[model samples]
Target: MARPENVKFGVLGKNIGYSLSPKIHKAVFEVLGIQAEYDLINFSKTDLSKADIDEIKHQYKGFNVTIPFKEKIMPFLDEVTEDAWKIGAVNTVRVETKGLVGYNTDYIGFRVSLERAFDWPIESAIVLGTGGAAKMAVAVLKDLKVRTIFTVTREKGGILGTQTLSYERLEALCPRTDLLINATPIGSVQYKDQMPISEALLKKQKGVFDMVYVPEKTKLLQLAETLNIPRINGFNMLLIQAVAAESIWLERELDVMALVEAIGPKCK
Candidate 1:
């Protein structure tokens, strides 16, 4: 049976005014005949704290973590699952009597997206961003046995593992990259017209995947399409991960792709 009532769910992060997660989750919940509501729980990084996060247990049933908070929100949780701990990022948290429990469903989303893509031998890949989502991308790339993975960071120093570099080196290295994954928020509502990596860089990619689902097609994806490169967006990942989060909260395995087909491109 469904756990007592997990009617309240939200996505927590900074500058999340553009998030489509509320609509996406609402659609899925409607299909499941679940009377539930999801919200965008946006907060400025400076104003949020462990006390504020832990207090969420009394306010909402559970919530999704995004962008800047994916890694930053971990310490505030009562428990972090092994998988999320291993990834060092937590994107989903369930509020219960015991406290807040953290989990990583972003990896689940990427893993499924990769499986659905055409079988292209990915010897190397260039992943954009160094936040929680980017960590998921690196983890999934390593799982695919990708030998060389370069993670792009905005600052001077980036994550310790892997070849962490800036955008300056992308063009020079793109020719060897079989996959270009955007883990950053460059293509969302805030940066709708911004393409982090240029058309010249996308031309060298065998495939491209953007982790942002808004606009359905991003500037980066449009460039990828023009380059005739195989492309995938974050819609599928978003759906699968939402299903996973609900399953965790409701304590049941959801038919992921079925729900995807049910929701369709109507939302886009």
Candidate 2:
């Protein structure tokens, strides 16, 4: 019942002209009859100074952090939630009158979406990439008691708590891996046909989850489908996280399904 002036939000990222976050958030605001404006703040690495971050906190009621800056922006935040601190990445920020607080809704999003897709518990997973998204996925998997999770990265060394596997080792690791998640941008719009692992490896997995949802059925998911593997796209995670972010901003639980319906048609 509050007026629209009470709510303002946006997403932060670079070269995110293709992102559906603004539309999704705006639709949620509309469906909830909340006065909110969701926009995008495109900032490159060099543009993310303390002053710049402070300005964003002052300008928007809250903002969602995205690619390339999720981890880097941590230091500029006034405080971070336990999950975000544990994951060492933040995807959502709450700009309160006191200060800015960061949180990782991605963890909640990933776990909720995966549980919906699979009734059974997820024991082990092979997470591809070592970026912020990968960190959040690993944190969620660990929370779910999936200690056997492995990390596959292009470069070696300095990655804590994960057995880095080279591309050559992928085939051997595929069968043992209960869940295969693509946290890299390999299947993103720009990298369409490209995937972190090969089709053969993907076919051997029990399930496939991609963090990139722009191309809804990413090549990774398509390959999984061909092999009859259970797959979940990034859209579900995006929606769940967006809902969580909205809750943080509004200080109330919004209708997640309504928001989903509003943004469903716009998602690719």
- Which candidate ranks first by TM-score, i.e. highest? 1
- Candidate lDDT (C-alpha), each: 0.84, 0.81
lDDT of 2 by residue, 43-110 (tens): 64544788888788878988999888898889888899887898889999988767889999998888
- lDDT value for candidate 1? 0.84
Q: Residue 25 lDDT in model 1?
A: 88
Off by over 4 Å in 1: 172-174
Clashes of each: 0, 1
Model 1 alpha-carbon miss at residue 243, Å: 0.6
